[model samples]
Each structure stands twice: as C-alpha cells, then as structure tokens.
Target: MRSCIWMGSEEKRMAPGQSGPKIRLAGFTKFEKKKSKPYSYSRTAKLLERFKNRMSERKDAFGPQVERLTVLHATVKKIADVERAKKHAVEQTEEVELVE
Candidate 1:
C-alpha cells in the first residue's frame, strides 16, 4: 500500500508497505526565520571572562548573591559590635556636664 505524507510545502510518497520515517523539508514562508549573527572572538572572550568572574566570586558554591549578603552581614555585625563597645565605654567612664 502506498502512503503519502504532507511535508512543509510538499508531499512525500512512500513505497508499498514501506515503513519509514517522514522527512521534512525547509520551506520559504512570508515570515522567514532570521539568521543569528555569529559571535566574534572578542565578544566570546568577554563573555567567558564575565562568566569566570561570576563563578570565582562565589564562595564555596554558596552563590554570588549569598556571598554579597554574607559580606554585608559581616559589615553590619562589625558596626554593631563597635557601637556596643562605644556604649559600654561611655557608661563605664564618668561624664561631667558644664554649668551655664
């Protein structure tokens, strides 16, 4: 038995009792797909550099954002410690008020 398969813009016929995969052909249409521009060597190198920097910035695979957050947390903690120490020192020391 002969079989016909409808391809992109053409029809494909199969031999009698021949079981085969249908082949598709590229067809031209009103809205043809736009071809992508090839990446230049410099552009590719820049992309690789950016990717490497991002990967290196990660701390122990915690991710870049996590690394940033950790740094921020450490800074805040340090500031808080300093402020606490200052408050403690002020409380321990005597402060005299001037009489007007």
Candidate 2:
C-alpha cells in the first residue's frame, strides 16, 4: 500500500470576512477596553544586567563545591580500595598452603 506524510499545509482556508467565537455573560452590562501596559526599557536593561552578573557568579560559587565533591569522592574511593586490600591480606594470612 502507498503511504504519504503531511507536515505543514501551505494553503489558508479562512476567508477575509470570517469571525471567531466570543463568550459573554447574560447579565453583563459593563464592558471596558483593555489598555496595553507601557514597556520599561531601563528596568528591563537593569534586570538583564543583574541576571548576567548573577549567572557569571554562579560558576565561581559552584567551582569550589564541585572540586570539594571530587576530592571527597576520591578520598572515599581510596579508603574503599585500602579496605579491600586489607581484607585480601587478612584472608591470605589465614589461608593454609598445601605442601606437596
């Protein structure tokens, strides 16, 4: 059987005079126009600058913590290795060698 895959349609089906649905209450009388809020360029710029500074400081803060964790993990691994070696040593000491 033949098969076809559809991605995005290039044609527009909506006409120029067509309108969408609107919701309204039965007893509503007051209808106020929504006003667009004014954009603050200075405040946005300041916040973006502060955000960049905080992001830069995060690396320095986490750098020490990451190093500390690495050192702790390495120390723990070394202790485990020493413990394993000690166990092998004790087992070997308690073993009886077969005489030929």
Candidate 3:
C-alpha cells in the first residue's frame, strides 16, 4: 500500500487512487526583462503633474463661464417669477415698447 504523489506535469495524479511517476521541474522558462530603459520615478511624476496642470487649466478656463451661468440662472428665475405673477393677475398685459 505504498503511494507516491504525481509530481510531474504529464505523469502526476491529481487525486487519490491515481498512480504515476514523479514529474521533473526542469526546462521551465525564466522571465527576463525587456531590453528597454527601466521606468523612471521622475518621468512618472512629471507625467502625472502635467495631467493635473492641464485639468486645472481647463477648470480655470471655465471659471468665467461658471459665473455667467450663475447670473443667467438667476435671471431666468426672476423671469419665471414675473411670468407666474402675470399669469395670476386678472388684468390684461399690454405689450409696451420702450424706445432706448
């Protein structure tokens, strides 16, 4: 009742009641680094910083647009309030043209 673990890829047994010769671990390929310059910390940092700077520049470009949008939103709200009041009024509205 002697048993041995199937240690070889082609001859190894994966479960009980399996019998086979021990597998050899030879000829396994070793990982070699590619023939190129290794990664640099400074280069990575510069790339990340450039990305952040570009994003900040875009945000700055939109700064004035944001203020305009805020003012436009307030103006639209006021127009809506006026329209609501006009709708609630029983008096007829006259279209008056002001000569500037």
lDDT of 3: 0.54
lDDT of 1: 0.63
Better of 2 and 3 by lDDT: 2
What's the TM-score of every candidate structure? 0.32, 0.34, 0.29
lDDT tens digits by residue: candidate 3, 1-100: 4445644565433566666565456774665667988544445444544554555577777676555555555565566667667765634333232322
Q: Write the number of the candidate with greater lDDT, choosing between 1 and 3.
A: 1
Any residue pairs clashing in model 1, and if so which? none
Error of 1 at 26 (Å): 80
Clashing pairs in 3: 8-23
User: For model 2, how does the per-residue alpha-carbon lDDT over 1-89 read when each residue is reduced to its tens digit?
Assistant: 22223337653344455653333568766686789785444444445445555555776766765555555555655666676688888
Candidate 1 vs candidate 3: the TM-score winner is: 1
In Å, residue 18's CA in model 2 sits off its true spot by 65
Q: How do these models rank on TM-score, best leading?
A: 2, 1, 3
Q: Lowest summed lDDT over 10 consecutive residues: which window, candidate 1?
A: 91-100
